[model samples]
Each structure stands twice: as structure tokens, then as C-alpha cells.
Target: MPNLKHLLLLSCLGLSPACIDVPPLEDPPKEDPADPDADFTFTATPAQEQVLPGGTLDCDVRLAWADTTGGAVTWSLVSPPAGIELQPFTLPKGETRATLSIRLGAGTEPGAYTLTLQGKSGTVTKQATVSVTVGKAGDLVVNWVVPTPGKAYTRGPLLLQFTVEGGAAEQVEILKDTTVLVKPTGSPYSFTWDTTSEAEGTYQLSIRATRGGAVFTSAPRTVIVDRTAPTVASFLPAKDAVTVGVRDSIQVTFSEPMNPLSVTEAAVGLKTGAGDAIAKSVALSADGQTLTVTPLSDLTAPSTVQVDLTAAAGALTDLAGNGVASAPAWSFSVPTWLPMGGAVSAVGGATSTESVVLKLDHDDRPILAWAESDGSSKNIYVSRWNGESWFMLGAPLSGFSAIGTNAATPTLAIDTAGEPVVAWGETTGNGDERTVFVRRWTGTTWESLPSPTPPSSLDTLFNPSLTITSDNTINLFTSLYDTAGYSIICYQHSNQAASWQQPWELHDDPYLFNPGAPVSTTSGGNIFVAATVFDDHTSKRNIAVYKGKEPYLGGTTLGNSSTTPSIGADSNGRPWVAWSEFDSAPQSDGQIFWARWEGSSWTAPVAVNTRATGNSTPSLALAKGGPHVLTWSGIIDSERSILVSQWSANSWQTMNAPLNALSAAGTPATAPSVALNSTAQPFVAWTEADASAASIYVVRINR
Candidate 1:
């Protein structure tokens, strides 16, 4: 440092003179080109361009400006034209670079436009030319494909598809011809057309595909909306009453064509004889007309069944809209009982010219008949009454081989159930013993009663009589003889419990003579057995009727003397007896006699018919609450014939006129058996020779 005073003066003089000479300190010496120290050179890339007419383009403007102060840069739009919008612009940090994007309005005119970009350093402008036109809407193309051509599908759902190309579709109309199926709004148009609602027919489908304010319809494609025709196949259980559960369906057969909806509206109904509709559930077949219904409950047999349909109801309708003219109702009957009818026969030959006689129950109709043939077994014959005519049951068991040799005449009686039963004897053994066989009819089945014993001794069971009581009990009576004599009367009883009582000897006598067939009748629980018993010499037969404890019931002989007394009892327990008496010797002709039993004894024999010839083999059948009909075979001239008479209005009416030829012929109709059915009409089973085969036959009396 210089000395304090003098050095200070020198330092001030130097500093002051220099400072004055600097000329106000001209800013640091300028470089060669005037202001070289200041920032100047910079450039922006791809800044200006022109766009084509109606064409779209994008422009990115980059900015570069030098800063004299050396700082960062940013850009912004300074001038924007009308209908123009500024896009995003960015700038770099600590540098002078910036970018901007500009868009022109759609309606801008074709002219030059300037883009002004302002940065931190300064603002710049870029010019562009644009040729503007107009915007265009998108186009649409539609197409369709038909899957099935002319084929008819079942009545149900159908599917279809549509295709659209070019621009995105806004709406799609799928039409079956002029009929619109689906009108939908969507992009990439496609649709399914359901033809379930359409009838069976060929159709054309057109798809109208629309897009972006433009619409186009595709060419119509031929499509068939076919449906199967309805049909009823067949009925069930076609023959008779069909038993089905409540849920079962009743099917009706249809030929063709049906509407399912219409069939649903029709009602299937069931009914009884009273015309009441049976409550049931009903349904229509898939194709319709065939209605299926179930009854609410089960039905009983022996009833009339009816299925009804109403005209107002749509039972079945075709595509033509033609319905059933009238609802058809079907009816059938349920069977109550099985059928039962067959032949009636006796198992023996007519050894004697005789009338076949049978008795019927109170509830049955009566049939009187007879049998006739030569004494030899071969010619045994039969004839009968047919409701409207006379016919035969069948040929008799006549020849020795047919009957196992030597068969006796037939005897008949009405069984417990009002059916006829027959019994007879067959001689097979060499010693003259006979087998007695029996059989009866019970409407549905034929029942055979077991013989009491096998044919045994020479003096065998003969002249067997059968009588069925009201309680379903059957009693049989026959003469039992030993080598000594024809003594005791043997009795057999059906106990009414499906079994028979043991045989017992009824009367004991050394010479009991011939005992006629027993006839029994009921008054409440009391049974009366009546018969004709011959005297010791077998000359005079006595009419006898018994009451109480039968077989052992105490009874007295009624009429003094009458041969072949045929006896019966009416519904009120009053007895009537008829017989024939020989006029002269034992070999002579006979006459008819009648008597009535009044509780204690018979009224006495009265002449019934008087003729020059013989009147014999008198048979009597008393109806429970009706008439007593009588039959007999008489000999007129040299001929043997048969006649019938009925007791009516306290007098006998001769039924012989219609049968006069037979009654007055050489060979009379004989072996007459009578039976009645529920209607109280007589049915006769007899043997006659006038017919072919000389067979056994049946005939129903007109009265």
C-alpha cells in the first residue's frame, strides 16, 4: 500500500481520469454483425401445408424461438379462424421448443388459413389452404338364405336369419312376403323370423336392412311355412265296454286336418242312462280333433255308457274351417250276466208208449211233453214245443248199445231253482237189475245227482220218482224189493246243504203193490207228499195225500179206487188229483177221473172225460198261484194218441183239438214232461215218432 496521504491522491487521480475517458461504458463490445451476442437463429418443423378437398388431415406444428435471456419456452394459439378449434400444444423445460395441433371447421370454405403459435420468445404464423366439400352417409347391403323349400313342418316354431353388410345396420325388418315378422333396431343387422303363427303355405321372405340413414331391402327368398295335418288313429277296446282309469284318455279317430286351439275349446263328455254328463277332465290331441278325456271316477257294470259332444263345442275343425256337422255320440252296453241256453234230454228209451212228464217250480213257465216209439230200443222218439213251433232236443238213446241195453221210460220233475230234472232206469246186468241215473239243469250248468246204489239184485229199484221242495231240497221215492216180495217204499232226500240224507225204507208190507210217483208242495214250511197206492191185488189204486213229518207223516188214503192217480197241490196248499179208471176188465180202455183234497181228505173221484177208447197215463202239474194243467195219452179207434187239458174257472178246458190227429192216431204222443220258466210259460220236453230221428224235443206252449 502507498503512504496514506500521497498514495490516496495518486489512486484518485488515476481512477477519475480513466472513468471519465470510458464514454459512458459502452455495453460489452459488440461482435462483428451488430448485435451478435443476442440469440437469433431457430426453426419450426413441418409448419405449413395444404389439404385436399373433403379430405381429412392432421397437422402438428412445432415452435423454436431463441431467448436472449436463456430460459424455457411454451406455446399457445394467438389467432384462430371462425368455426376452427385449437388442439393441445406443449413446450419443453429450460429450452425454446413448442408444438401445436389445429383443426378446421367442417363447413370451412376453400381458402388459405393462418395458424399463429405464440412462444415465450415471440409469436409466429403458418399458412395452410383447404379445399372443403361435403360429408357422406354409410351404405347398407342386405342378404337372406332360405333353409327349407317346399317341405311342411309340424305346427310349431320356425326360425330364419338375415345378413347385413357395409355400414352398421340401424334397423332390420324381416318380412314373410308382405307380412312383417321382426322389426328390430340394432347394429350388424340379423334377425330370426318365427312362422309359428302362420298357416301351412309357401311364403317369400324379404329382409329390409337399414343403416346410417340409408335403407335397402334384400331380394325375397322363397320359404315354406308348412304344418302337418291332424289325424285320429283308432279307438281302444273296439268291441265292448272298455274299462279304464279316471286319468285315461278317450281317443277319437280323425281322417285329417285339425286346429289344436279349436280342439281345446271342444268338450268331451260322458253320461249314464239318465243323460247326465259324467264329471271328467278333457284334453285335445296335439293335432286337435281327437279329444282325450278321463272320467272323474270308475264305472259299474250292467250300465249303458254314452260319450257325448256338443255342437257348439269345437270337437274337430279342419283348415277349411269346416267343423263336424254334429258331434257324434257313441253308446254301448255293459253285460250283466253270461248267456245260458242248451239242450234237455232224458237218458232212457220209451219201453211203453208214454207221454214224457215234467214239473216246474212256482216261478217257472211250464212245458208238457211226451215220448213214443216201438218196444224195441231202436225207435225211441221225442218231440216238443218251441215258442213259435215244435222242434226236437235230439235223438233218444234207443238201441241197446246207446243205452247200455234195456233202458226204462223217462220221468221228470222241476228242480229247486225252477229247472227240469230227469231220472230213469237202465238195465245192464243179465239178472234184470237196473241202474237209476239222474241229472238236472241250473241255467248255466248241468248237474247230475248220484245214483243211490249200483244196480244190484234182480228185484231192483224201479219207478223212481223225483220231487224238489221249495227250500231247494230234493226227495226221491222208489220201490225196494227183495226175493220174497215188492214190500218197502224207499225214500232219498237231498238235505238242501249240497248233500243227501241216507236212504231209508219208508213203508213195510209184504205186498205193498205199485206206488205211484210222489208229488210234494209247500205251504210255508210244511210239505205234503201225495201218491197213488194200489190195493193188495194191484186192482184198485187209492189216492192218498199226506201232511206233517213226511215219509213218516200220518196220512190216509183219499179216494177209494182210481188207477194211475196223478196228484199236485196249488199255491194255497189245496190238493188236486186226477187219474184214469178202467171201464171193464183190466185189459179194457180207461176213462179220466178227478178229485180235490180239502185238508183232511179228497172230495171223491169225478168223471173228467168220457170216451169210447182208453184214456190213461194222466199227468197233473199245479202252478203255485196259477192254473193246473193236465195231460194224458188216449187210445182212439185202433190208434194211440195224446191229449192235454187245463183246469180253468172250476172246469177243465180240452187242449186236444189242436192235437186231434195225434190224440186220435194209432201211436199216441206220450212221455210228456212239463216245466215253467220265470215267465210262468210252459216248456215241454217230450218224445215223439212223427219227426225224423224219433228224437227228444222241446216246445214252448203258446199260452
Candidate 2:
């Protein structure tokens, strides 16, 4: 035993007497602990898990992990307390990856279900969370190609396609108001329903499917069937129409395809004001849309006919088994004859000259150009019919008279290219000075070319008649006058070039009369111009035709002195000449006379106006296969008015007095020009020659 201090020292060492006696002790053996570093991972992201009732999850999920401790791992669900089954719940030893498969029972609620999984290697453990949601499944889906919503559905074949969802695909049916449109037992079901025999209306459609002993019906879908009757889309010789030709056939176009056999003689008929005309035959168009009726005799003028479309069901039924919307009786009046029209508006105030040019286009619309006084200068103006009234085109253009020059003789002609070429004569300075200015409508603005003649010249060129042929040959026929009087002149160029050939004289002899600037047209192989010559030695007037080249006169007609002679050629190249001649009946007063040029010679002159005390300046117009329109000015009933006459089938007919209803009824209407549109409607334009002022007037004789 030691003292107390010795005992305290021994206690501080905290060793037993036996330990102090032993030499250095060896280290104790190490003990293995639970593995806390073990981790759970996924080869791919844990899928948003789901399963059908009594079915396994549709996705395959792999749960992978690594553990340092040598032991097996386990996987289990912690939520949904019980009901859910996880397959291969344990990741046994040597298994780095384990597949998790789950099954849900019918009683499982369709909501989010959380599944907790755990894995352990020896004493190490890890957890993972998997959440899943459930939903009600779809069964049968019905889709329609025809009768789609918010569209104009017509009576026709209706197409439908069916998609079978996770339901009993053994039996499926699509119905419209209990009528089965499709009944099949397959996954891809398609059906076509012909509504040709169904009445037009709206209805509901649904799909029914049977799964074992249960049944499912889809939501309702809307369907519409339109079986409406056809209507008259348009009719030739339309309702309330006028100026219809004498040899027109009755044509009726329906709104839709019709039964070809339905358009028979008994189904449709035509009746004149007097009695019914038998139909020779009824023909349907290739499309089964248009019905044409052949009459026993040709339809002529001065007759009114009514078209009767049958209302009987089978007579005019469409493919949809419906008759026309209504049995419309339409009436169109054939012109009492030719040369029939009403009043048209006046241009300017009234003062226009023989310079007024009228061109009848292929559409039968009339275009005009003239010189007028706007209180200051004589500016040129042009107007065209916009189907209703005359619409002025472009701004008033410059005329020679505007600058205090000599006379402004404006002339116009249109090319096949749709460009209007206008030319005029003006004296620029005080001395022997005059030039023929030419310009063209460049589709937008007028482009002026160099003067045809020197700015200063002794001779004056007037009555500039411009013509552009189909081949774009620009020809200018004018009257060059000096102290010796009128000479026929011509200037040539192309519409594509700015330069004109040297001015040449067609009839350079001053003694010959280039009647009305040799009115020329592009209707023949060579340009045709109607010219006149006065034999001072014989004192007889002769109407002559000039060709484009050296041999000037093709033919000539011996007659009394003629003034302002006009010429026109029909589509057949038949030339017609009309002019105001010196009449001895009224002691040298003007008389309107016309003559036709046969291929061999001229026909004897036919007097158009004898009763009129004075008549002059005949404007001639001929249609391709239509009528001959002749317009002029004369005194009718002691009042100066514009007059018109038509020659057709070797017959001449007078028209209603154009100025018969004008406020200035007695106003002298001169320089009458005529043009015919595609409808064979006549458009007449003239100058109101009042003592105080002159203005332009227009009228459209529509059909």
C-alpha cells in the first residue's frame, strides 16, 4: 500500500494493477456496422406510374442501386396502406437492378396514389417515391367527313370513320335518330350514307358500343342534310331583256345538276304573245346543268316570248329528287326590229363638230372623241359607257384651237391593243405655220410624238384619221390643204417606234376631193379607204376606194357631188359607203344616201332620208355578223335632230327619234357616231348644235 498521493496518481492513470504489469497490449479486432452510404437509383426516371382496374401498370420501370455492404436489398410500397401489389419486392443479393411491377384492384380510387420503395444492403437502406394517377377511359369515337359543323352541307354521300377506344370492340353502331348508319364489329369502321332521298333538315348522331354485357353511348354529334330544290342560275334572253337578236336560242342554266331526262319537251315550253311554239328538241349540256330548247322556227324580232320552267316534281327533279324552287315564267322582248333605243345624256354643253368619232367595240360598247369649247380653248374630250351612263376618261387634252391657232380637227381610232390614238392639226405661229400633232393613250397617260410635219409650213393638215391595225401598223390618213385646196396625205409608223416615215400623198392632185379624210378601216387584206373625186371638167362626183399602196382606187361609184362620205366594212370584208349627197328634189339640199360594195361593183345608191330638208355627215358602222348602223343629222318635223337607220337582210329600218324627248327638242344634233357592244346594243353619240353653243350627247340602246 502507498500513501494517499500515490493512490491518486494511480487513479489518474485509470489502469488496473494487472494492466500495469502487462507489456504493451495489442489493438482490439474491428467490428462491421450498418451501411449508411448505400444509395437507390433508377436506370431511367421512375415512370409516372398508372394501372387499369385489375390490370398491371402499362410501363416497365427499372430500380437500380449500389451498396458497399454485402447484403440483399428490398423494395416495398409505404402508401395506399394496402390494395397495391409491387412485384419482385426484394432486390436479392447479386442483383444490381430490380424491375418494379404494380397491379391495381377494381376498388382502387382514380386519384393520385404514392408508392414508397426501400432497398437495403446489410445495414444500409435507401428510399424512392413513385406517384401515379388514374382516369376514366374512352370507348367509341365517331367522326364525319361530310355534314361537318358550321358549314353549308348539301344532299350527298356522307362519310364517317369510327375509332374504337378501350371498350368492347366486338359490336359498334353509329345512328342518326335510331337509324343505323354503320354497324360493324371491327376496330376501323367506315360508312357512307346517301342523303339523296332524304329531306333537308338538321338531326343528331351518336355512337353505341357493347362491351360484354355492358353498353356505352358516345356524346351526341350534329348532322345536317340539305336536299333543297334547284333554281335558275341564269337564263339567256334574260328577264325584262330588250334588243335580243331575231335568231337566238332559249338557254337555261340550272343552279345544280339535274336529271337529264327531266329536261324534256313536256317539262319546259316556250310561248309567244300569240301562241305556243313547238320545241323541235330539248338538249341537256354535258354537265347536265344547262338545258337548251330548239324551236321549230327561228325566233324573230317584233315578238315577245315567255319561258316556262316546269314545276312538276318528276318533270324537273334534281339528282336529290327535288323540283325547281319555283316554276318561274320569264319574259324577254325581241327588239321591235333593229335601230331601237332610248335617250342618252349629252356631253359638253352642245357645240361639237363632225370631229366626233364613234367606235363600237367587240363588246358592243361605244367610245367617242370630239373637240369642244370649254369657254376658253377648244380642248378634246373622250367618253365611254360603263354599262349604264357615259363616263369621261382622262382629263381634257390640248387641242390646236386652245392656243388661238387655226382649226382643231380631232380624230380618233382604237387599236387591237386597247390603246386609243388621237391626232389633230394646229397652227403654232402667225406665219404660214401648221403641224399635225399625234399622241397615244399609254395605258396611263398620253405620250406625244414629234410633229408629223415641220412646226412651220405653208400647207395645213387637218382631219387626222388615226388607225392602228391588228399587226400594230399605225397609219394616219389626213387632208393637206393649201391655197390650191385639199390633197390626200398619209403618214406611216409602227406602234412600237417613235419615228414616222416621210409624209407622202396618196392623191396629190388638188382637184380631187379626199372625201371626209378617206375614212379607212383595217378590215381587209389591205387598208380600205373610201375616197371621192370631183371631175370639174364633167362636174360629176365619184366615190372611190383607196388601197394602202400605189393602185389607189379599187372601185368607184359615179354619182352627184358628195360631202363627208363615211365607210365601214363588215366582218366578211364587205365594204359599205354612205354619204350626204346634193339632192335636186330640194334644190341642192343634202340627202342621206347609202350604197354597198359588192365584191365586183357598187350597188345602186339607196336614199335613206328624203323627207328631211337637210341631212349630212353619215357615220357608218358594221358589225361582225350583225346589222349595219347608219347615223346622221337632218331636219325632222322642222326640228334638227339626230337620226339613225339600220340595214339588215337587204331591208332598211328607221329608229325612234333620239331627241324626241330632249328639252331642246329642236336642237340640231350633228356628227352622229354609232358603236355596237357584245350584246349588239347600239351606242350613239352626237353634238347638240345650238345657235348659242354646242355640246355632246350620248345614248345607249341596251339589250
Candidate 3:
């Protein structure tokens, strides 16, 4: 085209066409892009938040900067609800995150709200939007931690626990009905409600939680406060019952329901009269109101058993958590009577006559006194069983030898020192005069007591009965007969007195014969006498009982056509009498009847012998804390046999076999006497007469 310069100029001048054909000088090499501004981005971890009135919510705000360095960022909330506040805070320079706390104040309305969070640094600003919800009363809930609803509480401490959800509790209170009972402050809210001072009734319980100035209450829970203690409603084997079975179980009923778990073997127990513990098992009824105690083994016969309920802490508790304040106890007894060893003959001879008197010493040894003739004369003799054989106590008490002058009607008793005391009637040579003699054994010899005054010459003393009192006094009762009539006399001799006391006529009715051998006993410092008197007007003999002295307490008639009256006393100082009564027409034999004097009157007479045979000469004795024992002679299968029976369990229980005359079927056994030992055993003494002579025999019954 043209010269270089010219061509260049022309090409340059021709720019329109040349510039289009030539590259546009490569657009002057474009420069690299520059970095962004040094600012941060504001964002929230969660886009939603929930908070209850008087509660707080926390949100995490993060800053993402484009550069390694940044200034402090101020935090703020936009368009927040009334009473809502954002905790003033700022993210320091070089920090990447900050916490935003949103708090709702008291009395704040509940609703859904949107909160805009703003963060600004120098001339830069960033914003984040978050959804917020203010919780209402329905959002706050209270749950019971223990003592579930509808449970009853007794007079004790009760635990109350509760938890608050959807809110923070600053203070918690327990409300009983509309009243505030207590204010508890702690985590896992709980309190001990002492109900010991509360009245018994139904009440409503609730939990009240307070945060800031707002309060929330839970629904009412129904509960019962029963502060009444349980009582013993009834028990088995009624107190002091004497007829309880050996295998009977004890039952105790409560006035209200009891806690089943509290009824254990350690809480109830049984014991023997000896204070020995008895093994037993305890059980509770289905309704949780009764408790039963069963012995592991059968109780011993003739033993007293006691039942005990413990009153110790944690021993027994009712459903309301009340404990027994007092221990309950009771006692009962079992009865048994069985014969011991075979009967032994005390004395046998060709001339042993009259009734034999028997007594037991402190050692339970048998002592005897009777009248026997040696063909030349009759005298009163004393003997005792050494647990082996009979040994004479001393020489015959009387020295009479004339044919008509003889010893008879010997009555025997034992003193407090376990010494023998004897009383008898001795007739003079002419038989029209008789004297009453009493003597006591002083270790080795018989010491004669003062002799009672003699009646008129024609009057004769026949039968004599004697007893020794607890105070060492001698009491003697006798029968006197004269031309005018017969009368019974009572005489007493005290160890301190100079001589026998003035005799008192017990009964003096002309139509009444001398009461035969008026039996006497001492109880509660008073003397009681019983006898058989012949009533000429009724043409029948009747039994009479008298108590005390001079101004007698009783002259009560017991039975008609009755004989052989025996008297005794009980632990309560009450008098008990037994006798033989003749049956009605067609029955020639007699029956034994017994009666006890109550505080005011006498109980109805009860028959002792079950059979209709001739039962006569009955003797009665009462054992301490035991039953009454009786012995008599009866005709069985045309043979005379001695019978023994005991009044127990409201009935008479007769021994299985006859006591005497078992080997000699035709021998006649008569005039029986009974006594009880210290161990409550019964001993019987009787007379057996064969074709040759009469003899005395003794037997015992074990418990």
C-alpha cells in the first residue's frame, strides 16, 4: 500500500476499515477483580423460639466475616411484643458468635410473634428474622411426683412431690383446699406434710408455682386425712375362759382396716402361764381388719395360755399409718383330769369304824385320823402317808377303856406349819356325858388345846368338825343333844387367847335335830358352816348353810331330804356346798347336788352324780384357780365303788374308773373325802368294809 510512515498514517487515517481488519489492540490487558468489603453476616441458629410468661428464651447469633478482622457488633431486637426485652449484648471484635436472650415480663399477653434480630458494626449492618411464641396458662403444667391421687393419709408425715413443666419456678407452694399449707424452695420440688396435728376429713390438694410476678396452679387432687387410731374391736377365747380347746387359735378384730404388711409374726405372740414363749404363725384377713395367731403345737393340758399384741414402734400400723399405743393381752385355760397311781389302803382291821378324816400337808402328803377298836376299847388314832406307807403319828388321843366310854367322830385339819390338828368327842363311862377335845401336833407329841365347857349332864356331845385358819386360830363345830331337843354349837380358840371363846348356839329350833357334824371353813377372815338338820314338821331332813358369827349372815336352806353336807370356799371368798339328796318315788338311792353362793344369792343346785344309784357321803374341795373336785360312794352293778368327779367347763366330768373296791366286787365302799394338792391334783380317801372288817384307802388323780 504506501510508504511505511505514510502507509501507517493512511492505515491509521483509514481507521475505520483498518481498525476493523486489525485486532483492537487487545483491549489494553484487562485487570484482575478486587476483594469484597470487610463486613459480617448476621444469622440465628434456630429460626423459631418459645417462651412462657415470666420465662426466658435463648438464641445463638453467628457472624460470618469476609476478612480476618472485624469490629464489634451491637445486637438489637425489632418489632418485639410488649413486655418483651432483649438482653443488651455485643459480639467483641474477632468473635464469631454471641447469645441473644429474650425475656417475657409479667402480665405479658400470649400470642405468636416475629422477632427481627439486627447486628451492626461501624458502617455495616445485618439482620436475622426469628419466629417467637409467648406461652399462655395452658402451657404451664404441674405433675405429682409422689402420693398419687385418691390416697388416704393417717396421723403421720406424708411426702408431697411435684414437678413444673414449660416454665421455671422461682417459688413453689402446697395448697390444701383454698389455704396455703407450705412454701417450699428447691429443685425437684417436694415437702413433708405433717398430718399429726390435722383434723380428720377430706381435703383438696394442689401445687402452685410462681415465676417473676406470675403464678400457675394445678388441678385439685382429692385426699383424706384420717388421724383416728385403730382400736381392738373383739378377741377370741374371751378373757379368763376356762374351757378353751388346746388347739384353738386366737383371733383379734380391729375397729378399722389395718396395713397388711404390718401384720407379721413378730407383732403378735402367745405365751404360757410360766412366761415361756410359744411358737406361733400370724395371718391377716382379706379385708385387712382381722389378725389370727395359730400355735405351732397343741397347748398343754391344764395350762394357762396368754396372747399378746406388741405396741412397739413399727410393730403394728393401720391403713392411715397410725401405730398401736397400748399392748393388748388376754389369758385362757385348758382342763384335764386323769388318775395317778393305784389306790393304797391306809389302815385295815377287824374294828375300824366311823368316817375317816383326811388332809394334805404343805408337801402334799396325806394325813389321816379315825376311830378304831382293839376289841378292848375304841380310841382315836392319827397316821400319815410317807409317799410309801402309813406311819402312826402318835398314841391314841383318848385313854378311855370302859365299854360305853369310847372315842368317835374325829375331825382332822392341817395348820400353817404343816402340822396335824385333831378334834374329837369322848363319852364318859355312863355315856350320858361327852366332852369335845382339840389337840395339835408339836413336832414329836400331841398338845391338847383348852377343853370346851360341858353341857348339862343329860346333854351329850356327838359329832365334831374342826378347821385351822390362816391366822393360826382353831375353829370347832359340834352337835349337842338333850331332853329338850338338839342344837349345833360353834367354838373358836385363838393362839393369843387365854382359853376357848364362849360357845354360840348356831341353830336351836326344838323341831330341828342337832345338825350332824356341822362342817366349818374359813375364808376372808370369816367362818362358814354347813350341816344336815332333821325338820320334824316337814318330816324331811334339809341342808342349811351359815356364814360369819353371832349375827350370822345366812341361814339359807339348800335341799330337802339331803345328808352329808360338805362345804368349801373359792378364790373370791364365795362359799360352795355339796350334799347327798334322796330321789323321788321309785328311786331308793340318793343323788349328790352342789351349789355356789354368789355375792348376793345362791346359784341353782346342780346334780353331781349322773347315775341313779345310791350316791352318798360326798366330799367337795376347790383348787386355787382350778375347778371343784367331789368324791362319793355309789352302788354300781350291785357292788359299792368310790367315784370321783370334777366340776369343769360348766359340767361335771367323772373319772373313768372307780377308785376303791375294784378287786373285791362285793365289798362296800363308803364315807369318801376329797382334797386338792398344791399342783391342783385331787386325792380321795374312803372306807371299804368286807365281811371281815372295815379299812381305809386313799387314791389320787393327776392333772
| Number of the predicted model whose TM-score against the real structure is largest | 2
Ranked candidates (lDDT, high to low):
3, 2, 1
Clashes of 2: 13
lDDT, candidate 1, residue 115? 50
Per-residue lDDT of model 3, residues 242-277, tens digit only: 657667789888887677656677887689999999
Error of 2 at 536 (Å): 1.7
Output the lDDT of residue 396, model 3: 73
TM-score, every prediction:
0.42, 0.53, 0.50
Of 1 and 2, the candidate ahead on TM-score is 2
User: How much is the lDDT of residue 550 in candidate 1?
Assistant: 48
lDDT per residue, candidate 1, 145-216, as tens digits? Answer: 222122223333434444454456666788767877778665323344455686767667677766566667
Q: What is the C-alpha lDDT of each candidate?
A: 0.50, 0.62, 0.72
Provide the lowest-lDDT 10-residue window in model 1.
17-26
Clashes of each: 59, 13, 0
Q: Which candidate wins on lDDT?
A: 3
